[model samples]
Target: MSGIVVFGAGGRAGRAVTREARRRGHQVTAVVRDPRRHAGIEADGVRLLGGDITDPRAVALASEGQHAAVHAVSPFTGPERGFAGLDPEFFVKAAEALLRGLTETRTHRLLAVGLFANLKTPDGTPVLDDPALLPPPIRPFALAHQAGLDRLREADTPVDWLVLTPPARLERDAPRTGRYRVGGDTVPDPATARLSYADLAVAVLDETETPRHHRTRVSVYT
Candidate 1:
């Protein structure tokens, strides 16, 4: 079985990816800030590792011997938590660390979960730019995410990375239909754009195994 290391395994996206990876018989290293608090994620083929996504040493430790790594780390969990202590360059640090660590470990593939705010509208305007689509208060988080994506795009590394951007309406409790549509950088129609966390995981693992896209970002929705 292929080994996959997942950062942010304690979060919704990370948990979904971990479940999908195990369901497909892939060995998973679930990296969280503290393994003790995330005891529930432990399973037959999953190994829980405590590590920081922005630390190259920790990332390298978790990435060693893994075939591919998933970058699902997020700084802000919810609006209720506020953005007071949020680092604007959180993603940039993560990209730098992941690239350096993965290169050192020879882990070639990196699959990342992206924010929908970065996707452009039909008129070529980013969703994050439009206050109607994205609230002004949340823009900082979106900008941080964009910075991380930019870092990945500008990097000259051997690691092949792909960022899967999900729609705004990502339902965590929705079932896995094993169905999703891939689109380019533009955002899909709001009326028709939706995706389940489970299905997103399916797409992540599919790319992990087959790797149809490389060194770029794509929108995934149902």
Candidate 2:
């Protein structure tokens, strides 16, 4: 089977996608900023390589001949880390590099993990606009994520891309139920909308192996 190259392989979403891809018997190239720091991700049928997601040449080098690429790279890990040196255009730059590099390598598919903050409420207000739903301090990071999504929408590249946005309550230790529902650009019932990282991986690989959504972003939840 053709391999899948995953950027930000050390991250939670990226790691889950890598695990699910291997579980489905596909070769995986796990790209991170430092391979030595992610030795735990190395295993049978997986190759760990160091590369920068914001660099087009590095993206092409890591993604050459792969079946698809997953963009799970995030400049901001968490709120405690704060936005000390956050670049507002981080995702925009990533989108540009991925489009250029993937098109150059002839890789036709790009699956990106998206933030739920940009999703709209029932009344059509973005989740990021609601301070109760999303803290005010985190708005910058969410906006950065939104910029990347916008960049993809504005591009005319041949690379087929999809962004899967998970709910706010993504449980790290929850079991994989192997089931999920896809929704539009609105936040599902915040009370009941939650997803396991494992199940999110299932949705990601399901779309990767047999894409049902194209050039669009969708919310995935349990």
Candidate 3:
């Protein structure tokens, strides 16, 4: 069984992923802002601990001694910043903290939950290339995801890292058949619509154990 550190256990995707990972027979450490608030989750086999994604020390503490980490922290939460408001400082700093923690612990694999904006059209154009196309609060985060992908690409660490892109749809209540498709870099068929959060978790765990896609980006859809 793989040992995992989930960076944002209280968030939607993070919660889904952590539970799914547990269901798949992996050991999980559920890192949250307040462990006491998540007593139910904590009791259900996750080792819950308080953590702040913006703080490297907290991130490192949470990231330590795990086989790999899933960066499922909701990257943005604002109305004005649009997609542009995804704080680069917060994400980049958190990444640095994670890297440090993993390096110190000598952990090897890292699978990141990248935004769909990191994907490119068949013509090599970005989906979020225009300001008008972006949601007022989500644009910044999409850009931050793009920037995070670039930094991850350039990181020459000893660990193996993979950046996986999830569909733009954030429908938490969607059904999941545990079946989906995965691709690299190029965008998937946008015409098909949203993917369930459960399917996304399946894809994440599949990549976590397989190691077939390393240090590159994989886009997932259903």
Candidate 4:
């Protein structure tokens, strides 16, 4: 079983990933901003790390000895999900922390949980280039997410990093058929549908173990 650390473990996707990791018998650590707030994360088998991802020392200490780590942090903040207060500094700091953790922990592989808006549009153009797709309000969020992807790529590190793009329609309540497909660069499914949070969790774990694509961006959908 792989030893894994999931950043942002208290969030929707993070919780699902942790749960599925345990079902597979992997030693899973759920790193969170506050352990007590996520009391349910505590159980017989899982290890919990309490701290903010903004802290380099904390991330390094928590990520140590893990085989692979998944970053589930959202670039979105506030009700508008706007980047009104968005600071690249936050993510830059996070990059430092994650790099340290990967180095100190000897974790050789990491997967970035990316967003769908970062995917290209129908005309085969990068979505970030199309204003209509992004609109006024959520545009900043899209840009920030895109920037994060860029940083992940440029950051110098020994660990292999893979970016996973999720469809925009991804629904938390979607039914789990345990069925899905993966496409690269752009969105895979023409249907433009959502995968169950459960199913997304499955995809993340599957990629971690099998890793068919390395140093590449992949999209998952049902």
Candidate 5:
């Protein structure tokens, strides 16, 4: 069983990934900002560690001795879920911290949960840039997500990383069919933009066991 550390384990995507990893009999560590808030993350054979992904030292300590680290951290948004509540700096800082932590902990692989907006359409245009597809209010958050992706792309580091971008409609609590399609850069289905978080976790773990994308992004959808 591979030793895995999941950052932002309290989030919807993170929880699903953690559960899937454990179901597969892997040693899973759920790294959260506050362990107290996520008491349910504690489970048999699962380790819970408290840390902030924005802090390099914290991330290093959490990542130590792990085979792979999954970055499922997202930006902190407010009620508006718009520009006013968007904080892109969080993602950028977390990306930097993950890089530092991987280097320090000797964790060679990283699997990041990326944004669908970063994927390009058939016309080679970023989906986030299309106003019709993405509302104005959510554009800032999407752009911020893009910044984090840029950090991973620009960083010259030894860590083997793959950013897995999900479809626009990521459904939580959906069944894990373990059936999905993977594509590069382009959105697999513009009309049917949907994917289950459970399946997304399956995709992330599949890549962890048999990595196919390195220092690049891939799209996954049902």
Candidate 6:
């Protein structure tokens, strides 16, 4: 079994992935920006490495010798930016930094947490483009993720990557049913865009354990 490195391990999604991977008995490394604040992760018997995802050197150090890596880092959400709100470009910056680190280290395996807005409707139009489907405030964040996703697709690298897009509403602390339906490009159920973070983490870990949907985009829903 290959050891897995999970970026943003202190975040909700990152913690879920770390927990799931550890449950599977695979060697796991949880990378966070602050070690003192996230000491609880170390108590889970997983190695806790302090590193910033936006720093190439830090990311490379965390990626060293790891078989796979998961990018679950999200931007800081708040109204501190006044009406303009948070910097939407944070996703692209973080994604590029991690990509650079992975490419430099020849860590070919990567799975990134993606936005549901990137997924298409049944009619073949990206939900991100539909203002009615996506709220006004979050449009910027969605666009930022889309930009990052576009770059990933255009970049010609040895990395075997997949962006795992979750549903619109990702519930935290929900039950881990360990069952989900996989879809390509569009959501499987147009009516329901909801999934538990635990189940989504299961899907992520499953894909990590076995190579599936490589160099592609996939979505999971309960």
Q: Give the Cα lDDT of each candidate.
A: 0.94, 0.91, 0.75, 0.77, 0.87, 0.84
Q: Residue 45 deviation, candidate 4, in Å?
A: 2.1
Clashes of 1: 0
Residue 125 of model 5, lDDT score: 85
lDDT of 3 at 111: 78
Clashing pairs in 2: none
- Give the clashing residue pairs of candidate 4, or none: none
All candidates: TM-score = 0.98, 0.97, 0.89, 0.90, 0.95, 0.92
Q: What's the lDDT of the predicted structure labeled candidate 1? A: 0.94
Of the pair 3 and 6, which is ahead by lDDT?
Answer: 6
- lDDT (10s digit) by residue, model 4, range 160-203: 88877777777877766777788877775434657787888888
Task: Summarize candidate 6's per-residue lDDT along 1-222 as a digit string, tens digits.
Answer: 678999989998999999899899878889988889999998878999999887888888998888899999876532254326556667667777778899888887899999888898889887888877776777777888888788778777788889999988788967999998889989865557788989989999988888889888898888
Per-residue alpha-carbon lDDT of candidate 1 for residues 1-222, written as tens digits (9 for 90 to 100): 899999999999999999999999999999999999999888565899999999999999999999999998998887788887889999999999999999999999999999999999878889998998888989999999999999999999999999999988999999999999999897678435899999999999999999999999999999
Predicted structure 1, TM vs. truth: 0.98
> Model 4: how far is 53 from its true place, Å?
1.9
- Evaluated against the true structure, the overall lDDT of model 6 is 0.84
Write model 3 residue lDDT over 118-178, tens digit each, in one string: 6776677676874443554565677666767777778778768887777677568987789
The ten-residue window of minimal lDDT in model 6 covers 77-86
Clash number for each model: 0, 0, 13, 0, 0, 0
Query: What is candidate 5's lDDT per residue for 1-222, written digit by digit as tens?
Result: 989999988998898899889988899989998899988888566799999898999989988899999999875533255456556676788889999989999999999998887888888888888977677777778888888889999999999999999988888867999998999999966657789999999999999999988999899988
Q: List the residue pairs that clash in candidate 1.
A: none
Better of 4 and 6 by lDDT: 6
